[model samples]
Target: MRLSLISSIRRPGFRVRPLLGFWHRWFGLFAALWLALMAITGSAVVYYEELGSWLNPDLRQVEVINPALPPETWLGAAKAEYP
Candidate 1:
């Protein structure tokens, strides 16, 4: 028996709507994942210094001197050297 065009065609019941719906669902899932990744990384960038300091408190700490000079005295010394 000879095959007709309609009979020879594969997936006779295939429709555009279902195919598009499948693609849409996957696209939305991937887009949501990418957005979440960007948001997390962006927050990390915004708080880079704080994150580093929190991770290494000893390295970020500064030593304090008891007898620190006043700002006026430092300014006078700087002006004398420059002028």
Candidate 2:
């Protein structure tokens, strides 16, 4: 006698509630995972600058300068790099 898995699953007394329950559990897990991912990314976007500063401890503070650099000087440097 050969035992077939399909035959057992197709038995007339087998109930579908268990299969539905299994799928329901899986769907709930996926939905929760997707929501969690979205929430994490959304929070990161909302706190982008804060997150960057937190990640880079060194950049959180700068040495005090008596005089700030001129805007023209900053613009020149940016143009030099980008152009």
On TM-score, the candidate that comes out on top is 1
Candidate 1 per-residue C-alpha lDDT over 7-59 given as tens digits, one digit per residue, 9 for 90 to 100: 67757677778889999999999999999999999999999999999999999
Candidate 2 pairs with clashing backbones: none
What alpha-carbon RMSD in Å does predicted model 2 have with respect to the real structure? 9.4
Residue-level lDDT of model 2, residues 1-83, one tens digit each, is 24677776577977799989999999999999999999999999999999898899898888886778899999999999999
> Which stretches of candidate 2 lie above 4 Å from their native place?
1-11, 57-83
Residue-level lDDT for 6 in candidate 2: 70
Cα TM-score of candidate 2: 0.48
Relative to the true structure, candidate 1 reaches a TM of 0.59
